[model samples]
Target: MASHIVQNPSAGCIVKFMQGNEPQIAWVMEEQKGKLRLFLPNRRETTLSPSRILPWAGPSYPATQSKDAVVELLNRHRERRERLASEVAPMELWEMAQGEMERAPAEWFAELGYTSPDADAVAACGRALLQCKTHFRFQPPEFEIYDAATVESRRQAEEAARVREAMVCGGADWFRRLWEARIGRHPAPDASTAPEEPVRGRLEKMLRARMRDPETVEDEALWKQVTKGLPDDPHLALLLAMTWGLVPEHYNFWLDRADYESGTAWEEPLESETQELIRAVEEGGSLPPAEDTVFISIDSATTRDIDDAFCIASAADGGWDVEVALACPAWFWNFDSALGKAVFHRATSIYLPEGNCHMMPEALGEGAFSLFEGQARPALVVGAHVAPDGTLGEGSFRFSTIKVAKNLNYPDCEAALDGVENAASPFVESLRLAAAMSDRRLASRVEHGAVIIERPEIDFELEGEGADITVKLRPYPAAPRAQLLVAELMVVANAVLAEWAVKNDVPLLFRTQDVAVPREYAGVWKSAPDIARVVRILVAASLDVVPRPHAGMGLSAYSPVTSPLRRFTDLVNEAQLLSVLTRGSVRWSREELSDMLMHLSIRLEAAGQVQRFRPRYWKYLYIQQQARAHGDECCWKAEVAEENDMWVSVSLPEVQLGLRGKRSLFGEKVFPGQELHVRLGKVNPLRNEAVILDVREC
Candidate 1:
């Protein structure tokens, strides 16, 4: 997390805090630690120690200025939300919501002018009530509160010091990872080829070898050539794995490839997590120690800062297997730890064009806790013995330390179709089969649809010095075991949570992106027929939930379970499941659950934007550098890959970019089918926006 914020451009001239914007404060009427505090934008450089705040800022000032201004903003917001919320119930149900917002520091409420805050409050409650106990609140303090001693210059000086000291990138190990991120070819270079291969004929020959066999070949020449080709960065492969699922963990397992390529692969501690796993295996015992509690597990995207394992079993009924997995973050860090929350906020792993930043540390991500191959690492398996048709068969959910026997990737699992050594074992094969069954279960729900988008990715060659990377699909992009295997397991587990909630009448987050209706989602799918079709298609995929099709994935009720590293929804999904299934937590009232869902849905959307736009801005920068010769107004031809009422996926192979539309560009209305010039214009440095202009006028 970058601690030093550049400036507060959005800062209003109200009150101040220690020479900065104490623009926002979080005050739950009950507990402070339970929730987070966002002080204007984000408290990036500020070491915000939450002080018990009593109504200090005084009554509302309206987040903006004029009564008319407040009325305009609040009224407009209310109108939009009321239309959406009308489907649920009468507006009278959310009385508690008004109270919660009122308690949010008088200044915060006042910022919105409180002209008719009750209405805004109602809308907020309705949205939250609808989604995953989630919703976004507009909190603008009427007047800023400040201690007012320090100057901006002094604050800047202090912030610089904090950033320099806090950033571990100041160290060599971290620096090396960042360096390779700029210019490294992902998957390690050594893993790309053998120990020796002529540089000239390398690309063509390796392409051929890959076609012959994607698995590791004991070729020394290829091994050496890989080291020569790849940059020494541990985080590069980690980054690729998180974003595109292109680089598999097979490329850098154990320490051989990691040490060879990252320059410190062999530097495992004798008393480290690796040693503990080996020791446990030697002793014929569970991973680490039965009583140690914290397990250090690692994957390509995650490092050794995890303390639990999870797997699946069948449910009690003669149906699909129920999934049971252990999450030890509760034992490792608290909600208040700045670092911990940052990781939690990320919700899932994000693979960057160059490197990856994991949600947790390396020790926890890949340690004694991780269910290692041929070793029974301690795990909290949520197993479901699902039937071939995705019905919940007999299942069990428990914590245990069991040997995983065979660790396999997608290709390996696929190869198991043929007789191959180390093919996906029966245990994995069952999970895959179970996932397929769950898909059928999901498919049975006719109202929702799942939108599957193949957003191509990139591998940058950044080694300290930034090299421009052309983002594209992996040359031979194929499905892998880990991808869908985890997906099905999570869906089933999420279903379990939903089932438990309903059985107990626990109110919980039920997520749904607003459908493409005429008034709502008008940004896309303008035509009534097109909008209705999109909604029908999406609603069909959003299964097992009350809402109809997602109108996106084509799944009536499609939810993501794979990456908890980058998405908050995944974290909430786990939390809900654990609370309901494991601890037998009480369900919130439907109203409460609805509120939570609104926030979760909104945050998930926000987090996705943050994850997407940040690196994408950087990628766009590199793209311009890569295709600088194409000039600005060439015929950047594109074929309509996918489209809805709101936007269309337009692919232009020339500059290698996809243009997303504010509204749908479906059917014959787009390029590739016709000649259209796309002007790759200016980019906003802060928003990270790459503006695309249609230049038929050219």
Candidate 2:
């Protein structure tokens, strides 16, 4: 059928055929039906079909001609055709024939370039068209011309392909050399060994981007091609980025993973809002009324965003009237504005060993909205009368401008409670009253099935920056004196405010823990073993628009409206409460608030991961440093929380770290509440792994 379709060449006729990418000249020595016996240029004989012949064929030769003569003729023809192909400018020919016709034979193109073109001229035209793929597409008998737009696009793509090929050949090897140089596997490479200009810059950018977010990398196919021969390591991009000096050692990739922006750069777009807030704070007198409550705030010494404060006074019925003043950015914050959206994306402030990532701009959170001592600031103040029996009476919520009388740190307050003169001495009597009320409240909550764990805070101090950084972990007071007062009063304010919301039927994001706990699990727990035992059976709190009982707090309902400057949920709740107090209606309906919370839940989960893991990352780094400095001689105190045949879970109360090891390392009688000292081995901070080398019972 192919013989019927294709015309067979006569014997001894020189023809052109394709051998891979190059064209070859061959003489037909014999013909049989569709088959032809041909002699190649190298004096080799082969049989081929007539359909295999290229479009162009040459003049015939004598069958009895010498082999040398035929070979010489073939070489001469090959040289002539190649030279003609070189002389034909593909672009010039494309310009000449582009608008002339949609498609044309090679002979026609040769005729357009020459008067009465020969077979060599036609074949050269075909060869040139095949080589110039951007302007023309070859299809056997004819070549198709591309339009101007398509030709330009294809030309650019062809150029990019060439560059990519060049990068893969040279850039990959260059990166390998740099990586080897970084690890001391090879000598450092010189500047001359780097890839040229655009490739070097582009490669560095790509590596950085991949290191930031590896899963969503652009040009992933090209990345695979370029990194084909590199080690199949998950942290390859990070390693390469470090080697290229794009990032420093121990870079925070978790921030990149969550797409959480660091620093005040995110506050640039809200400059106008920030300035407006500052002006509002400076102007003063825009609130509902001014309160003469002389509230005092108790927080860590490093705290700048003072959101909540409280003051106590004796009521007529021998009860303490407690008033709480919370920083109110809700009065000026526009929830529909860009700043609000950014704040919502952050969800909550993250306190890490490195620094605090505030939810709101510092201009507003720390300066304007914070309840700074002696400064008149807008506040959402809640007042409730706590009876001598610790029963809370009717509460009131109002928007007021208040000034904090003192800003006391925990240690100074504790010393003041012990009758040591300090800045907190003026409030010593009031602190005693608050502590007495805290004791009664703790007794009342425990009677109602509350489980309170008073865990000491671990202060992480960093001495340096980057790779040479050192960390020191110091445990704050285990049985806190002043912290208990602040915690109980804050919990009372939230519970009363939540109760008020229920009566008013206003929607707030209430924290609900609707689980039943055994009455035996109710008292305060201070030891690590005691805290861990009670915590194992407890469920985490959940958020909802409807009011429900919070089992852990032992309250009828609880809503977080204390930290408006640090948490988005508290700001929203404050806004709702302010609206109900002013206009007698809620700002957001139940359904609308629920829908908004769905989006916030995702961001909160991401923020929680960063908050929960980033500090542990630093703690692991500290442990590794300690292990290296003292080897097996360094020991850490651990309390066994759980034990099984396979593994033992222990809690290190000093650093607030938890670890698990094989049961065999803890001897035959490892049980809960058992104290031991462990030596860490095989510590890898990046992977969050620290193995226990040896353990000894204390």
Candidate 3:
């Protein structure tokens, strides 16, 4: 037994004390009142009370031990601690399972020199290892661990189970659950009313089989399988189809209403007779060539289907003799044939950011019928004499063949016309004559109620594919002089042909726009919004057998006789003109023409939607990509074009994006013509959505 003596310890006095049931040796450093400062053999110092210290009994080393002897004692203790640590290092149950141990018990831990207090404590550790066996594989009964191969096998089994469960419950049922959750309604409790197991199973199987190979929802067998015995709900069918990957997220449902193909492929290959005719045209026939005329075509650099080219020479009667050569595809085209019917179905070429879907076959549009330079192609040549004041004399129209002198893009023509010195440019005189013609035409149109909107055109070109895709936006240079020249020439050619058609009593399709405008509202409006308002007030232009005034162009009559490569209406008109010149009769009567236009109108409306919406889709995608690349802090300078009580319509002229913003962001001061700085957010290309986040005065 140890005697407990409560006495104050002096400085440098060695003492023994109990530290958590283990005895420790400490030397007293100082004593003050009720506290003693003690330094342990491990060099840790602490303040304690007198009651905590015990009198020393075994050795008086604190007074007689040399510094070397004390250090040697510490070194021996450290060696013992390190040996113990090596023997009892905490083993991860997983590491233990990887070794020779098949089954471990509490005694096994003791045999391995584990440092737990008792058998029960070791057993508690074994229980913890058992719980870890789910992620780690362990033998049962006394659970010890297993190797990596066993763990991987368990993981694969779990994944297979999960996949099976998902197959049974995922496709349509998952979509149905989401729909129910979104609408805040639970499924009906009647199991009998629910879709039968076999039917649901079949649907799921079909969906899973096509998981990697998706097809359009229009596939008859797939559609039948998806909708069999399901409720007659279009929304539910659409949701299931979308969820199962049968349709794209941004798919246009309106596209399904029409039967015409929208890709680059034709509905059917050209008939053998049509092919022969095309070959014949390409083989070069004997035809009268125009005399001493220089025909130059002004178009885009990428223009391939060259339709019309022009020449301007001084007439003997104090006027400019204009010769407009229209590419005569109608000479080979059979209006009553199947190829003609196919063209009528398409109605017009669809232009998108990706490219164009040509109305005529490429073999004709870009080959034989295309007015390539140095190729003497058949043409409907229209001759007119323009006076110095730009008044047209009597015009003459006939069929002839002419070689195009030059094919000049807008830039080249504009540069040459601006007197920017190019070597031997042949179209300068013609360009000058074109400018005079445009001035005269503009003055005449302004005298009427023609409104021209000169909005900058934004051209979108997509490069690469997938994650590497980049959208390049360039402003299509509006070369006013060059554009006006082409516009005036096309209009004059159409006017000349329309006059001849009327005088010859030929029943041709005429573009008529008869709107009841205010008698006082007769002036040329150039601004976009102003022109848009005028367009809204006017009736939509339409095709008719009867000749009528085109109020928008301020013409007594108008018809699109150019660009037969692109527009089916122009091709139809060309065929009519050709028949009148050759056979002295029209190809189609007024009734037959009206019947064709009715069908063409429906198809045209659908094609128009594709043309209008697809570009807008890509434009929205561009904005989305821009927002993601530049982040939220980027602000675009926008002008308010129109405003209402709740929204302000703003136009981003740089990107040609017109979007609306909340009126509250800009306060009541935001009105039309107000320029503002705006930030975009929540741009979703798949949904074709964008939102203006904030707006402030510039």
- Model 1: residues with Cα > 4 Å off, grouped in runs: 1-348, 374-378, 385-396, 418-442, 445-464, 467-476, 480-482, 507-510, 514-606, 629-637, 641-649, 653-657, 660-698
Error of 1 at 308 (Å): 10
Highest TM-score: which candidate? 2
Estimate, for each residue in 250-332, the C-alpha lDDT of model 2 and write its tens digit. 77766766668888999999999889879978898576578788899999988999999998988788779898899999888
TM-score of 2: 0.91
C-alpha lDDT of residue 449 in model 3: 60
lDDT of 3 at 218: 33
After TM-score superposition, what is the CA distance of residue 282 in candidate 3 from its true location, in Å? Answer: 2.5
**Best candidate per lDDT, number?**
2
In angstroms, the error of model 2 at 496 is 1.4
Candidate 3 stretches greater than 4 Å from native: 1-258, 262-264, 271-274, 286-292, 315-319, 422-424, 518-529, 684-689
**Which lDDT tens digits does candidate 3 get at residues 392-475?**
566687887788888888877788888876631666887887877777777676566665556678888888864356777889
**Which regions of candidate 2 deviate over 4 angstroms?**
1-14, 59-65, 148-184, 187-234, 285-287, 477-479
Q: What lDDT is reached at residue 157 by model 2? A: 98
TM-score, per-candidate, Cα-based: 0.44, 0.91, 0.65
In candidate 2, position 686 carries an lDDT of 65
Q: With candidate 1 superimposed using the best TM-score fit, by how many Å does residue 192's alpha carbon deviate from the native?
A: 44
Alpha-carbon RMSD of each model = 28.1, 3.7, 21.6
Please write out the lDDT profile of model 1 over residues 264-364, one tens digit for every residue: 22233323533443455446543323432222221333233222233444445545444444442222223444544444444444444455544444343
Selected candidate, larger lDDT, 1 vs 2 = 2
